[model samples]
Target chain A: MKLIENWFSERYSDNLQLSFRVSDQLLSVKTDFQRIDVFETYDFGKLLSIDGTVQLTEKDEFVYHDMITRMPFYYADKIPEKALIIGGGDGGAAGELLKLGLKSIINVEIDGQVVEVCRKHFPKLTASFNDPKVKLIVDDGIKYARNTKEKFDIIIVDSTDPVGPAEDLFNEEFYSNVSRILNDGGVVVTQSGSPFYQPRGIELANKGMRKSFPHVASYVAFIPTYPSGFWSFTMAKKSQIKLRTENVEKGEYFNLEIAKSSFALPEFAKKLTL
Target chain B: MKLIENWFSERYSDNLQLSFRVSDQLLSVKTDFQRIDVFETYDFGKLLSIDGTVQLTEKDEFVYHDMITRMPFYYADKIPEKALIIGGGDGGAAGELLKLGLKSIINVEIDGQVVEVCRKHFPKLTASFNDPKVKLIVDDGIKYARNTKEKFDIIIVDSTDPVGPAEDLFNEEFYSNVSRILNDGGVVVTQSGSPFYQPRGIELANKGMRKSFPHVASYVAFIPTYPSGFWSFTMAKKSQIKLRTENVEKGEYFNLEIAKSSFALPEFAKKLTL
Candidate 1:
């Protein structure tokens, strides 16, 4: 491991910054899209950042990956066979989809550098990228979702924050395209930021989701690496979503009970949905 | 506001630190028991730290207070009248207890400095301390619980982490004393640490609670100022605990739905309790 003495800090907001004592800088690359940096930290194991924002940490990536991939599957009436992942360059979401035994997954990632670097540094996150079921595609997710003739049983917009390249993906038009490309009874799940720190972000995602689907709701999963740790995911379905699948898999964070319970929001979170 | 260029950072672990930009240092007191420092933060409003650990921030204090006081009330067969609060020197728990319209509340705090400082700095948290229902007692919480002659309908252990003066509160002996002084169908709720970063802390709390009461379980509430933002509370009772009281109070984080759902832990959290 390459060693360094300087600490790596991510400014979560104008007032809050989270600092990690780094043991080594594993890789740094500046692509046309965004800057990617991977570091080996003393306590959190590995860290990934894009444009100075923490994308995932090895210690807590499983919590995000498990919730994003497994929560929607539990609500589906039929077993999911095909999934389309948008902007999950880290491959964490793709790896989780592979666990569902899906026949195929079209992972559209805009930043190839993110995937290439994470593949080298975070093997655990990219473990299933080499699986035959996952088809990695380097393209703009909104464009692909709009133009693709193929319909997906499940569509996961595992994009970054609503800024830069991922900004378009958080709009009504993108959600409308997502609705068009989804099979009957298909569900779309997108990571909405923390309600505590970014309540407006969740409100925007909820408004966009409601515009495209009859049934829309936000679910919460606590991720320590993310801002506020109280992260949310907005789910939109053609029909009202309910738990239909039983224990298809046992995970460290997601289970049948959690799938149903995660949707129950605290009063402040409920206000954001309103 | 007394502006400072320097940041106030709390070291979460050997390698992790959370820093906040401060507008002013409102109070800094080295009490005989613990060091209490209150600051006006740029984003989180007011922040309170004890022994160099963040106890609460104005932006998220309601989430912690609402969950701690309201969760156990749902498990009680009757409206909690005589409630006991230990180590909630900040007065956040006492404020919440007053909302229940309790007949009497005995708040035993070891550190008077924490209470006096917070009362002056954080009026929102300490608003109800002067209410006729609350009785503030300055003493050791463990000794107070063990030696009190009066029985309580609810006993809330809102102590600090399992260290220094608060270490004895995490043991089975303290929980046994809590059981002895509780009315029938009473509940003992203690602030278990975050399940993400401090799983062992929660496990130990659960073990101790189980040793004293037949029905013991842990619930979760996301408090952004805490270590992982994902915090847990361990509850023990003489018998099975379920939804008995309804609509006692509405809060920013606590509700009937949240009370029922918070008990449904993520798979990893469930493993911690196991």
Candidate 2:
């Protein structure tokens, strides 16, 4: 597992699965399918396929980088002045936030190894490292959120799934802190888990966000590499902000209409919030 | 692989790496990240997984089933007195046509294995098997379409990806035959490939459908099981027929609003059609 780590990849989400492939190995992984027997070839900030299908190439990262960043930006009412990213040690989130031309941005990540890994393997992704507007802090996101004395225009939870160190990110306390650190009219968005298979997690996260903010909604996009392809994201607003999707639309993946439409929920999904 | 295939599992797709686990594998796959070897199983239907990074599942038949049967029935403006389902070996498309209460329906499927497989592995999915209104014609859909004397109100092409024997299903000759067999105001809908992954396929299928019908429109839906979760279907009307989604309202998946929106294409996809 030590052979491959920081290969660049882009991810495209459909309503079915999240697929990741390595350009070097030509190894691809889709929902229910993988090129078997992968070994880690390096310690770069990405997952690579050596003997099986764990390649994190540029294309795979492309989808995530575009989606988590671009989707929310489209809906943001204004070009953000300040931003905070929780997790995202790989700096992809910070990289995307920097593109927003924010006045200031802080990336709070738990794993210093992950940060160093990003610095080495994904230089293009972490190019925002030296940017004047960005700060990289080696701290758990929840702790940072709880202690933050400053407010931000947008909060992006680019954390890993709620396991291991990230489990705390899923708890209600973290959500409360997230709300506390937001400026007035601030909006927060995170990738909530799957809707097709483990709907409960998404529902639970949605509930947590609901308690933290007056306006909370879950919308979905399809990431083929994920288990069920139907991946969801939950958004919380400090105010009843009409989703801020406006004409700043230069995103390759997201647009104004998609930004609005994505917030519309299906009944089975709506049942979760109830 | 043999050891893991025995485990029954469900996969959930979130924007994070895909999650998979045993159905009662005690701990279901979670975005929370603690589980090791999170996606290790590969049911024959769940084709692939990579150290639980990317999880793919059995191809879902629901999105295709709902679109093909309903689109034509809604567009025909006449009760479907007779219907034909080409290559709907899974029975999902057949089941949808049954919902329209057609007097008689024929499903021409070349592969008995596909039908048998769906009945065994996806029984509730193949529930249309027992319906008396449906006649299972175990033959090549193309051959049947070429020879059948009976005029049909609607015909649905529910074939596989165009890589194998299903290749001919997208050509002009087959659509020409379909046009000859349809009664006045008759219509057709065929599953085009994922516009996100296979944009050219959708465009070609739409082009073929257009040659046979005066009115042709393409609609898309997010299906997590397909390559991109965004699957498109081409609907062609034989005559100037009042169309769009019927007045039918869906409780969860589809509705008039989404129907209109699904037809809205991304510029890349639109450029393909042009």
Candidate 3:
């Protein structure tokens, strides 16, 4: 007797890959921008992939969303009232931002299909789309960042890796445009890729953000579903970026100590920012 | 066209696995203790596997070795003179300890074949084995810890996962014996498995060590090749554990900030200690 096996793998490089045994492919769609796929896995729960890369898993999405959103929110000088989330079509970032009592959140995603698909399959992440404060816009984030007339207290570039549609988001011009649309003392944070597997992600984001903002810092979080299980995020602010309070509420992966310690990068990763 | 591909994968669970494409299988041996295999990989350099789990990879071994050895050494009240390493057959732990100007290091490994194989495939890690201050003891580490009269300034439990040959190492009896064989103000550090994948590793170590030591704390480091790319370590000391200095010479993954921040556990991981 022969047994049939099904697996979904994301190849980090020619030599390294991570595989998850899947029970079924829940959804596969070819959007105008990229292909989005979701799978039902035995261990990681629901798995989401974009362009053959692991974006988030049901079991570990809290780590990514919590770090990406809460780190900058708490570090900002003031409680941000208005937030602009670029490329967060899945609504996870917007959901996290909403908890902070923001007056408004504008999530500009390039692909409408991603938002539609996520709304169908990822109810928890996409639930924020229906919130009165969250305004979902299916448009190019780069264009929106460049042309927006409104000012924001916080801008989160929750984009994919600096490739394909999100390539422009990591350049100096995009950050300069983003800086122009920010209120005084505003903070902007971008999701840099894994420093271990893709050092250029942080390097490019850091180099670009440094050109636009007075102070920029890079921090990391452990997202087991992502490449190498280590992921990076870069924050740029008009003022200093420091811990605002020790009483910040803790999430699954976020706490007062982690907020401070996440910036303590390994030597190899620290060198990438320089 | 016909294409051939070779890959070595370690299944962490029925649903999850990590695979590395190998250029060649350098060696495969079965000793009295376990099966040892070595492979030359494309990205990770040489890979070493014992009992089908990644023990070390040339690319990321520094993260594991540095955290396991240096954190406790730096946190110790005084400079550690004598070090006892249990089950670190790869010699990486001893190599790091030697850098701290230790008086002597006794490495008790159950399987001598792991040492012999590593010496041939990974000369850099095993180079410290021949150092005058280092003694190679081919014996059961648990037995040695239970019966030995020697006391150490730092005892590092560098064993594999708490299973098979290392099962007894995580019990209260072993930690009690380890505490007895430590000099005043001595510290014992054990490599807890990934808290995300195996919470029991840290739980057991923390439970057992608390029985004997006045202070017990668990910390974590990012090891990409490990099961979840996140790993935990537990340290037990007779006195309070605090940062000793700020000028610890930086390793690839160890720095003064890391020395302090490694103790900041994620909320989920922190709950495991309770």
Query: All candidates' TM-scores?
Result: 0.96, 0.75, 0.98
Write candidate 1's Cα lDDT for A60-154 as tens digits: 88888999999877776688889999989889998888877788999999988888887888877787789988999998998998899999989
Model 3 misses residue B59 by how many Å? Answer: 1.1
Q: What is the DockQ of candidate 2?
A: 0.19
Candidate 3, residues B193-227: lDDT per residue as tens digits? 99999989999999989999989999998999999
In order, the interface RMSDs are: 1.0, 7.3, 0.7
Q: After superposition, how far is residue B6 of candidate 3 from its true place, in Å?
A: 1.2
Task: Please give the ranking of all candidate structures by TM-score, highest first, separated by commas.
Answer: 3, 1, 2
The complex in candidate 1 yields a DockQ of: 0.85
Best of the two (1, 2) by TM-score = 1
User: Between 1 and 3, whose DockQ is larger?
Assistant: 3
Candidate 3 chain A has its poorest 10 consecutive residues by lDDT at A238-247
Residues A154-211, model 3: lDDT tens digits:
8999889998989999999999999999877788999999999999999999999999
Could you say which candidate leads in DockQ?
3
Backbone clash pairs for candidate 1 read none
User: Model 2: per-residue lDDT, tens digit, A61-113?
Assistant: 55555567766665556667898988776677778777777779898877675
RMSD of 1: 1.9
Query: DockQ values for all predictions?
Result: 0.85, 0.19, 0.89
Q: Which residues of candidate 1, in runs, are more than 4 Å off?
A: A1-4, B1-4
Interface quality of candidate 3 as DockQ: 0.89
Badly placed stretches (over 4 Å) of model 2 are: A1-56, A241-248, A264-267, B1-60, B71-82, B112-130, B143-153, B179-187, B196-200, B213-217, B221-230, B238-261, B264-274
In model 3, which residue pairs have backbone atoms overlapping below 3 Å? none
Better of 1 and 2 by lDDT: 1
